[model samples]
Target chain A: MPFSFLLLVLAGLSVIAYRFGVSRARAVAPGRQAVLHSRPMYHGLYVAIWCGIPALLVAVAWVAMQPILVKGLVMGGLPDAYDALPKARLDLIWNDIRNLALGDVVRADPAPEIQAAAETFRRLYTIGNAALTVLCLIAAPLAARYAVRHVSIDLRARNRVEAAITVFLVASSLVAIFTTVGIVLSLLFESLRFFAKVPVLDFLFGLHWSPQTALRADQVGSSGSFGAVPLFSGTLLISLISMLVAVPVGLMSAIYMSEYAHRKFRAVAKPLLEVLAGIPTVVYGFFAALTVAPFIRRAGEAMGLSVASESALAAGLVMGVMIIPFVSSISDDVINAVPQAMRDGAYALGATKSETIRNVVVPAALPGIVGGVLLAVSRAIGETMIVVMAAGLSANLSFNPLDAVTTVTVQIVTLLTGDQEFDSAKTLAAFALGLVLFCVTLGLNVFALHVVRKYREQYE
Target chain B: METAILRDTMHTLSDTHAPEGEAAPMTAKIEARQTNVHYGDKHALKDVSLDIREGEVTSFIGPSGCGKSTFLRCLNRMNDTIDGCRVSGTVMMDGEDIYDPKIDVVQLRARVGMVFQKPNPFPKSIYDNIAYGPRIHGLAANKDELDEIVLTSLEKAGLLAEVKDRMEAPGTGLSGGQQQRLCIARAIAVSPEVILMDEPCSALDPIATAKIEELIDELRENFTIVIVTHSMQQAARVSQRTAFFHLGELIEVGDTEQIFTNPKHKLTQGYITGRFG
Candidate 1:
């Protein structure tokens, strides 16, 4: 019988439990009157919840793991000639076996050995599925009968239910925690792999960066240099410029709107500022590429200075505009959250309105403002489209905003975007960059939360 | 005392009071005549008239939203701080109309300082919190003079002994009662003639309440104080004059001893005797 049959059987068993529990409850052991306490329905439900929950989970786990376990056992039987093949080639053979088992045809070299492997794969999968279903059929009702017979007034059924729920919730929380740990561990391992192949010191300290590799054994200008210093420099320069624009403008506006602006004006202006966030980064990317870049270049040219066609200045300016809402929205919330009592106290002290805001409101709001700005900086650092479109692809290792430069995200975009050999150092470099980006952002987010939390503790 | 007590017993509420210049004249530091206040369509204050005497503690006792605080705010034109609150009355201080168009509300507020229910200390050092009032008005010539003012204010508030060592510490770092005193110190540093306290003891413990009440008595010697309180006991203990407000009307006003001992108006009696506020 399948697991569905077992569930139906348990449903039938619960009906029997219900009927028998009531009569059994009425017919207590000679002098033990408190032996049966709960209503018959509760006894039935208690047994049913126990039987169904564990059995279903077990059956699902078995169903998911059966195919992989069987496939591994079957693959172990393959000839040593097949076993000695490279892992990638073996993986391709397994893919063929998977496809054939799922009735997907493959046009690769068809040997009798390959055909036989496909057959074994399909046959074992059906056998395991049937075996697991039968196991579930016998397990659910026997478990339900035991729980039903044990159900009594003093049995603590509610306690058992609560414990089960607690376990389930803990398990769900662990899944999220494990996923985060897995991602960080993978990034750490791959970045370690990247560091092994490329010299760590040079990657951190070199001035120039150009990642290139030979297309064939004979064709190469350079083997490839993965000195990541310039990419890091470019990311920092753009993020610095972005923060320079975002922090002051965002914090001051948040202070003004939250503290000074009349209700009618705040009601109108806050949403209008938020509309800046709603416009897409791709749109800002276009604005930077088509309009702002040309304007900056012309402006620079009039001053007898050379500005790159795709200047970091244009990308940084647009990105600054892009991240303003992030800073303002969060800082605004924190400023608004500062108690009205503080402002009233200032006013009562004969402090002028401007003095009250400057000396009182802003300091109280500082940590939250810093948190908002840090989050925006992380956002600016990871920003891809505007930089990719406006900041040039050359890893120009220069500090001047007028010079064109590329960030980590833009290089990652250029590297892993099309058909390519996954084994190549060139393709894997994208993951390495991704790993680095993830670490920086994770650190920044943690620090931002820490600062904001510390600030809250100071007052309340 | 019997004749005066008899007069308090038979009084009924009237916005218009007969002139009390039988032998000489009555002197009022601040008087509101036919005062009415409205917030949008809500008539928050009915026609109410009263006087706040100088160098004495006057307390307004009423239930919430009865406009005792609103009327207190009107004395310094603090009603101008709120939007959509309309006050139609003449409030005179020292025989001058405080609501005259030429009178600056800011300058008026400087001379009529207020303390709020919750302690709202600026996120600054103890010295800065007290110096804020005088510095904005340019009361001090230099930092040394400002330091003296802060120290003097703290001493006056009785916080000097506790917080003098930590004068550079954040004002908000102090305890709740201490912060309230700091706020009081902040208000007093400017040497205002009149003080309005809006439920200043509402957010304090009984012990803190006692300390604030004592401070009020001490401060009354130099400043005319108007306190809005819910505690009848507090008003009786601290105030020289007590006014009972019910639903925005000043139902009765007299010496606190006589008013608590024998109130005339029915609503005033109801409020004082724990019947209904």
Candidate 2:
């Protein structure tokens, strides 16, 4: 039987078990004098969990073990001469047999012994699946029957069912946490491999970055210099420019929305501001490259100044526009969170509206605004697409916004995009860059949370 | 109930007669004539006419949502901050119409300050909280003058001795009663002619309440004060005259002694005797 078909049957059985459990609970307490300890719904859930969980566990375990057992039986049925062959050749033959059993085309004509092994593999797999299906079908009803018998008036079915749900919720959250840990561990191991080939200090502090290793033994002019200072500096320059544009604009708009704008205007404008955040970054990339970069170049030449066709200014300016909503939305919420009593106090002191906002409202909301700005800064540093399309790939270690520069994210994308071996230093550098970027962003998020928490404690 | 109505009419006749009959009549610092307040669709205060006497603590006593606090807010035009709150008719301060279009509310508020039910000290240092008003109104010409004003305001509010050492500490860090006093000091720093307090002791304990009442009594010598209170005893203790409000109407206004001992209005009598509120 197919795995999905067996799962469907088990699900149907659990539903029937739930109905049976409810009826049994009703029957057990037929007299008016006898009261139930838990609700009928809890009793039904308790029986359903008992029926489904054990069968699901058995199904998972069977699926996990069947492949190994069937592979072992197939190997045993092969000739004794196969055991003397090398491990690689033996693995290739096993793969051929398994493919042939699944009715796939094989690489070459198979030997008679190999053909016999394929037949055994198919028979063993079929029998194992059939046995799993039968066992699950029987086990579900038996567990459910035991649960139904325990559904007495004195049973604490609610407590038992709630405990099962708690465990399931914990397992669900663990999947997300474990996935993050798994990704970090993989990045760490790959970065370690890259570090073995290149010294950490050189990669961190070197001024030049050229991640092209020699493809041939005697290839010339392909020395891979993995200096990362230029990329870090570029990231900082772009982020700084973006913050300069985003913070004042975003904070002013937030202040207007919270303090001055009428209610109807605020209701209409806030969502429109957030629409900027929903635009795809790829669209911003094309906008930066095709429109803004050329405009900057032409405008700079008009002023008797030189500007790169792909300048950091274009990408930084566009990215700043992209991040305005992030800063504004968070700031608007925090500013609105400032108590009305505070504004009233200032107003009663005979202060004007601007005075009240400047001296009272903004100061009270400063910590939350700082946190929002920090989050925007991290987002700017990690932004890739706009910089890739507009900011040139030249690793110029300059602070001038008009000069072309590249960031770590753009560099990582360039290093790993083409056909290449994973073992090369060029490809591994991407992992190293990824690890550093992750740590930086993680640190920023932690600091931002700390600031926001301190702000909460102030008013609370 | 019939006799109470008869006495109420008789007392109203005597109230009009006594003021003209006395040799020294108290001047009305603020006069509201035919005042009505509307909050969106609800009629909050209706045709209320009253006078807040000069240099005396006048208390407004009523149940919750009776428009006593609403009337107090109107003295300083604090109702302007609320959306859709409409005030019709005249509120005259020293014979000047406060709601006139030419009147700058900032200047009006500078002359008439208010304290809220809750202690709402600004999130600033104690010294700065008091100095905030004087600084904004340009009342002080220099740092030394500002410092003197802050010190005198704190001294007048009776908080200088308790918070003298922690002058730089945050105003919000003070105790509830101390914070309320800090707010009073902040109000005094601006040197307003009148001070309106709306249930200023509601968030405080008995000891804090006693302290604030004492402060209000001392402040009456320098400022015209209007207070709203839920506690009848607080009104009797801190005010020379008390006005009773029921629903949205002013039931009666008289000397505190007369209102407590010989209330004419049935609603005022029921409220004072704890029969029904």
Candidate 3:
């Protein structure tokens, strides 16, 4: 039996002990009520967790080390015949033996010594797991008996239980923070490796950005430049255009919903607008590429201006349409949250409805509105699928939206996609771009949080 | 049970309570004739009739949700903001039917200003807070005139000297009392004929309550003031006339002295003597 299974049986016995303790406390202590010290429910839960969590934790520890122990014993038992083989062949034989012990069907051939080692591995697993479980089961009930008997009137069992819950919550939160740190460091490490091979100055400030360096030093026509300026510039231009399309339209819609529209109209329009945000970015990508790009091209042709088929304008406009609900929903909430007292105050001052909204309501909600805008901007910058599908791959660093351009996200996708070797600078450049994007978004989020906090202090 | 029918019955009941406040010795500023108020199917104010005298402090006292605030709000058309609220009969201001379709709510609010139960000052500079009403109505020609209006209004509310040096500070930074006074100043800035207060001292401390009470006494000489209060003693001290309401009906109306000292209806008797308010 595993340590966990033994602990599980101990946990059941602990509950029985807890119940006996409660009945014993009632009988010995001379209380009319059957319950004493803590509530019956709390007592049961307390004993159960004590019997379970700690011993189960040790069971986990024992399980983690089991493979290492089994491997060691098998290696020590290997006959001298196996030791005579080459390291590769010996490793293969050991691998086969380990697999055979686990009852896995492995392809490699095993010697007589390897087979003997496999038998020893199975025997050790049975002895170790069963011994651990049986020992834990006996230990759990004894501990439960001690804890239940010691629970006095002054003992803060509830507080201890609450503290345990708090620890669990903190641990879960630490996982998220740890994962974020891990991702950042991974990006940093890969980006640093790429920077070592390609100059940082060139990657950051060079005008030409084409990463097609050959593995063979003497190979002809495989040399490449690695300027990231074009990608950055393209990202900025596209983001600006998206904001241009999204901000006013979304804000106006929010204002209409909050102020002018009736409840019936608001109920219909708000969800319809939110549906825009819910549509997948892939759908947006296809719409931008197939429908919007050609439209922009023809419209530009009519105006006698040349327009690329995969123009940033097309991609940005579609991206803007995709993000409008973000602006509308958040702004609508902020605007609606502008207290009814504020509106009433303005109205009572001989101010018209529009005047009240413009001077009083909007000013109160300004910080929230700014924070919403920042969130929208960061979303636009980090957006990948739409730009990847619609925006062209060529890094044309220009302010003109009608030109074909590429963002850092699009390049990052193209750089690492397909079966590329991880050690290559091209693949690692993706991590460098990811690091930059993460920093940008993180900064935006922090700034937004600050603004929102300040806003809350002012109004709420 | 519908609000419309309640108002009709209230008009008949109003006669018994009509002469409560010395019959407005000067003249009636705004009079409600057989006017009733309702929110959805709930009869908030029964067909109630009363005269708000020019330059006099009149108060309506009642238990919680007894429509004291509802009646005060009707003077300035503030109830228009509530979706299901309906008013019948007529609320006349200076012989004009304020409830008529031709009347503009914004104009009515300007003519009849209100100070809410909670002090809600605009989150702007002290100067701008007072200047808001004047600016919206275009009461001033230039920055100098606007500055003058702000100072005069602040003076009227007795907040000018305290806030004079810190005119640009955010109005929200002020204490609860000062914020209420600032709201008062903002109301007077528009120079309305009447000032309606809805339990103005409910959110204030004792000292702030006394100051506001003093301001109300002084304001009675210039503006028609109607205050709503759950506090009977405060109503007795400030208001010349007092109206007692019980369960959406005006039980009695009389001079504060008479209302406090004498008995009229069983409900009114039950209320003042602390039998069951």
Candidate 4:
């Protein structure tokens, strides 16, 4: 039977089980619902879970294991001569057999022995699926009947259902955590491979970065340099410029919106300001590359000063504009969170409006604002599209905002976008960059959390 | 000694006795005549008239939503902070119309300080919390003078001895009673002519409430004090005069002893005797 058909059958059985459980509970209680430990709805849900969960698990397991089990059975029945082939050649033959079994066009006409193996594979797969359908058909009804029999006045149907829901919620959260760990582990392993070719200290501390390695021995630029210091410096410089622009503008705007703006104005204006954040970063990239970069270069030429066409200033300025809503929204919330009582205390003491906000409200909201700014700084450092389009990929170890620079993300994108062997240091270097970026942002987030925690205790 | 005087006054309460029968003829430090307050469409405070005498604790007592707190906030124009709140009629402070256009609100607030229901200390060191008012008003000429003002304010609020060693600690870190006292000290540091307290002891325990009540009695020696309270016994203990409000109208105003013992209005009698509010 098809998987969808099996699912539909399981669903139908669960519905029947639910109705049976509800009617059975009612029949046992007659007119005494108060005597039952749980309501009729919980009893119904409990029976449905018992009916559906076991059959669903069996179907899922069979679907996962059928191909491997069928292939194993087919291989055992094959001729002994096939076992002596190398693993790669055997894998090619297995691929051909699978294609032939599915009636797909194969590379060539197969031998009679291979053709027999494909037929055997097809037969085994059919038998496994048919058996799964029969077993599920029996398992659902039997489990549901056991549940119905157990549903007495003393049964804790609510507790059992609640426990099952809790297990589901835990499983959902664990998937996210495990995926994050899986990504970090994969990055770590690939970075180790890259480090084996290049020393860790050299990659971390050396100033030069030229990642092109010639495939032919006689080709130019054969000796590729993998020093990452320039990328780090460029990332830091752009992030610094962005923060310098973002912090004051964002914090002041937050203060104005939270403390000064009229209620109707604030209601309309806040979402409009957040619209800047909602604009796709890719759009911001083109805006930087096409608009601001040329403007800065022309303005620099008018001043009789040298400026790169793709300068860090343009990207940094645009990135800062992108981050304003992030800082402003979080700061605005924290500022608004500062109790009205604090402002009242200041105003009551003969202090002016400015004094109240400066001495009391801002200080009370400082920890949250600091946390927001740090998060924005990390976002600026990791931002790829804006820096990629506007900040040229030169990797210049310069602090001047007028000069072109390439960040870690830009370098990673440049390294991995083209056709390249997976095992080469050039391709694996992207994973190494990814690992370092992850660690830096993780450190920043941890530090921001610490600052918020330490200061929040005094207020609470 | 205070309780003896309170008991003696309660026993002698009569309608014939003059309201201001004390040896010294008191003058009104703050006076309101036919004052009305509205929040949006709601008539929060009706045309209420009262006198806050100089160097006296006059408590406003009523049930919740009776406009006692609203009247207290109106004294120093704290209502201005609230959006859509309108106030009309005259409020004269020391014979000057406080609602006049020329009067600077910032300077007026400095002269008429306030303490809130809950302890709202700035998230600053205890010393800074007290010195903030003086520094902004430029009351102290130097750092030593500022320190002196902070110490004396704390001393007057009865919090100096306990917190003298930790002036650097955040005021919010103090206990509930201590934080409230710190707020009182902060108000005192400005040397305001009047202090308005809106249910200042409502959030406190009995012991903290008692301390705040005692502090209010002491503060009355220098600053005119107007307090709004829910506890009738608290009004009898701390206030020299009491005003009862019901449904946004001033029901009665008299000497605290007379109001508690021989209330003239049936509504005042009903509220004071716990018959109904």
Candidate 5:
């Protein structure tokens, strides 16, 4: 049966269990619900939990194991020559058998022995599903009956329901944790493979970064170099330029909104400022590449300075504009969080408005502001689409914002986009870049949280 | 002492005997004439007029929201901070109208400092908290003078000996009473001519309140003090003159002894005798 249909059947059964559980408790209490220890709904929920959980667990386990068991049985009954075949060839034969059983068109014509195995596979699958349905029938009613029989004035149904919910909540949280672990492990494994092919030292400290390897030994200009120094420096230069643009503009706007703006103006202006954040980064990328880059090039030439058409300055400035809301919104919250009492104290001291904010309010809110800026920095570093479209792909290890440069995200996208073998050094290099990017962002987030938490402890 | 207590009680029960003369000399430091304050059409203070004598502690005693604190805030233009709050009529300080547009509110605040009910020390070192007012007002010429001002202010507030060793510590880390004293020290550091305290001991424990009371008594020797108090006994203990307010109206002003023992108005008599708020 489809899992959704099975879930619907269990839901119907639990609804019945809930009705029975509530009526049973009422019957025991005779004419007075006041005699029951817990609410009627809690008792119903307690019974529903028992009826649904055990049957659901069994059904899930059966569904998970059914295919593996059926495949094993089919493999065991295969012809004697299959044992002599190589593992890959045997895997192809098994795939044909399973596809034939499912009544899909097979890739190849099946021999008589494989045809027999396909019949056996279909029969086993039918029997396994039927047995699972029967087992659920026995389990749900038995658990529900037991729960209903145990219902009394002293059952503590609320406690049991609470415990079950706690377990469910924990399992939900573990899903997020396991997904993160799985991603890191995959990155680690692929990067290890890449390092085996390209020396780690060259990837870390070497100055050059052309990943095109020579297919022919005599191929000219294809001696691929994997020094990541240029990419790292390019990332740093762009992020620095972005921060330079973002911090002052974002912070000043935040202060004006929080301290000076009237209620009607702030209400309208804040959302408009935040709309900058909601504009897609791809749009910002194109804006940088098509508009800002050309404008900067023309302006720089007019000023007698050499500037690349696809420059880090353009991408960084556009990215900075894209991230203004991130800094402004967080900083607005931090400044607002500085208590009215503190402002009152400063004003009562005869300090001017500017003096009060500078000497008292800003100092108190400093740690949270720094933490917000750090988080914005992490956001800037992880951004890919902006840098990919505007910042050019030549990995120049220069600090000049006017020069063309590429970040790790841009290179990772370049390496992974085209058709290529996954096992090659070029493709695997993407995973190594991913691992480094993930680590840096993770460190920044952790440090930001620490700083924010420390600031909170100061006031409260 | 027993006979005096008996006679005071006898005088309080029958509100006919006029009490002794005013305890302080008659010299008005801040005089409000027919001051009417409105907060968005709610008449918070209605045509109130009173004199705050210099070099003496005067107390405004009233029920909650009786507009005593509102009248007190009007003295230094602190009401200007509130949205939609309007104060009319003339408030004269040293025979000059303070409501004149030429007068800077910042300078007015420097001359008239305030202490809130809750202890609110800035999130800075204890020394810095005291030095903040003087530094902003340019009361100190050099670092040594600044240091001397801070030390003297702390000494005046009676917090010097307890915190002398740790002037560099954040002012917020002190105990509740010490923090209140620190705030007092911060206010005095500016060398203000007048100090306004709004229920300064309301949040404090009995001992802390007693110490603050003692400090208020000493502070009156240098600066004119205006205190709003909920505690009738605190007003009688620390204030030389007392003004009784009820429902945004000043009912009577007299020596503290007379206000408590022989009130002139019915509302004042009712409030003092615990008949009704």
Candidate 6:
């Protein structure tokens, strides 16, 4: 049977088990629900869990083991000469046998022994699936019967069902945590492979970052420098510019919304401000490149200043606009959370409205604001599209915002895009850059969380 | 109970003549004339008129939502902070109409300071918390003068010795009673003429409440104090004159000893004797 069809049968079994469990609990108690340790639905859920979990586990194990067993049986039946072939060639032959068993035409005609081995493979698969179906059919009813027989007025079905759910919840969280661990390990492995080819010091400390490695020894001037200073400086410069733009504008707007604006105006304006965050970064990239960059260039020429068309200023400005909602929304919440009693205390002390806000409210909310600004800075550092489209890809080690500069994230994207060989130092460098970016942003996020937590403890 | 009521009425009638008698007459610090307050459509305070005397500790005692706190807040225009709250009346402070638009509310608040039910100290060092009002009002001309003000305020609030060593600590780190005293010191740093306390000791323990009550009695020597309290014993202990409000109306106003011993109104008597809150 198809996997979905098997799932449907199991679902039907669960429904039947639920009804049986509920009726059995009621029959045991007659008309009294209070005599039962838990609600009737809990007993139903208990039966359904017992029926579904074991059958699903069996089906998973069967599906996972079937292929390896069938492949072993098929290989055992292959010609004796196949044992003499190398592992790579043997894998190719195994693929051909699988294709043949699945009724697809092979690239070339296989030997008679291979064709007979395909027959064995198909037969074993059929037997394995049949046994799996029979096992599920048996296990579902047996587990449900056991649960129903054990059902009593004193049974704590709720505890058992809730414990099972808690295990499931823990397992789901473990999956997410393990995925993050897997990504970090993969990045580490590739970066180690990269450092083996290019020295770690050269990658971290060298001044130039041309990643073109010549394919042949005779190729000239393609030794491929990998200095990260220029990228680091570019990231810092752009992040500083973005923060310089975002923090004041965002904080002022937050104050106006929280303290000054009328309630109706705030209700309408807050969501409209948050809409800036919802606009895709790619759209911001388009606006940065198509509109803001040229305008800056023309304006710069008018002032007798030289400005690159794809300057860091354009990208940083647009990125700042994109991050405004993050800083403002969070700052607004923290400001609003600074307890009305604190403001009242200030107002009652003969302080005017502005003094109360400046002296009491802002100081109370400073830690959360610092955390929010740090989070925004991390976002600016990791931001790619706006920098890619508007900030030029030249790794210029300059402090001038009017110059073209490339960031670590932009370089990672450029190095990894399109067809590439993984064995070369060029492709592996992307993983190394990703690891650095991950570490920086992770540090920032952790610090932000710590500050926010400290602020919460202060008030609560 | 009937004889007690009759005796209270007689005492009130006789004492009514004593205030006007004249050799050294008591003066009104704040005079409210037919004050009306509304929150949207609810009549919170209805046609109330009373006088808060200078150099005295006067307490307003009533159950919850009896408009006692509302009337206390109206003294310094703290009600202006509440949205949709309206106040209409003539409130004369030191013989000047405080509700007049030309009278800056900020300066008025400086003259009439307030302490809230809950101690709300700014998240600053204890020294800075006390110095906040003086620094804002420019009451101190220099750092030394500011220090003097802070020291005097803390001394007056009876918190200086306990917190003198930890003046740099955050004001919120103090114990509940110490924090409340810190707020009181913070309010007094600017040297306001009157202090409006709305259940200031409600959040304190008995010992802390006693310390604060003692502090309020000492403070009455220099500042006019109007307090609103739920504990009748607190009003009887700390206040010279007591006003009993019930259902948005002043049922009786008399000397504290008279109000507690011989309340003129039946509702006041019941409330004082713990019949009903």
Best-matching candidate per DockQ: 2
Can you write out model 5's per-residue Cα lDDT over A21-59, one digit (the tens) per residue? 888888878888887888878899999999999999999
TM-score for chain B of all predictions: 0.93, 0.93, 0.92, 0.91, 0.91, 0.92
Clashing residue pairs for model 1: none
Steric clash pairs (candidate 6) = A206-A227
Q: RMSDs, each prediction? A: 4.3, 2.8, 3.6, 4.7, 4.8, 3.4
What TM-score does chain A of model 3 get? 0.89
By summed lDDT, the worst window of 10 consecutive residues in model 3 chain B runs over: B5-14
lDDT of 6 by residue, B1-277 (tens): 7677556644544454345325225788988877889999999987667788899999999999999999998899999999999999889998899889999889988999999999999999999999999999999999999999999999999999999999999999999999999999998998999999999999999999999999999999999999999998999999999998876766678789998998767778889999998
In the order shown, the chain A TM-scores of the predictions are: 0.87, 0.95, 0.89, 0.95, 0.96, 0.94
Candidate 3: tens digits of C-alpha lDDT, residues B1-277: 4565455445536557556446556778888877789899898887677777778888999898888888888888888887889988799899999999999999999988899889999889898899899989999999999898889889999999899999999999999999999999999999999999999999999999999999999888789998999899899899988888867767677678888888566566678888876
Output the TM-score of candidate 4. 0.95
lDDT of 5 at A44: 92
Error of 1 at A324 (Å): 1.1
Native contacts present in each candidate (fraction): 0.59, 0.65, 0.74, 0.87, 0.63, 0.74
lDDT of 1 by residue, A303-367 (tens): 99999999999999989988888999999999887887887777766666788788788888889
**lDDT, residue A422, candidate 4:** 94
Tell how far residue A45 is off in model 6, in angstroms: 2.6
Residue pairs with backbone overlap in model 2: none
For residues A336-437, write the lDDT of model 6, one tens digit per residue. 999999988988888999999999999999999989999999999999999999998999999999999999999999899999898889999999989989
Better of 1 and 6 by TM-score: 6
Better of 2 and 4 by DockQ: 2
- What are the DockQ scores of the candidates, in order? 0.60, 0.77, 0.74, 0.76, 0.65, 0.75
Give the clashing pairs for model 3: B7-B47, B20-B253, B20-B254, B20-B255
lDDT of 2 at B12: 59
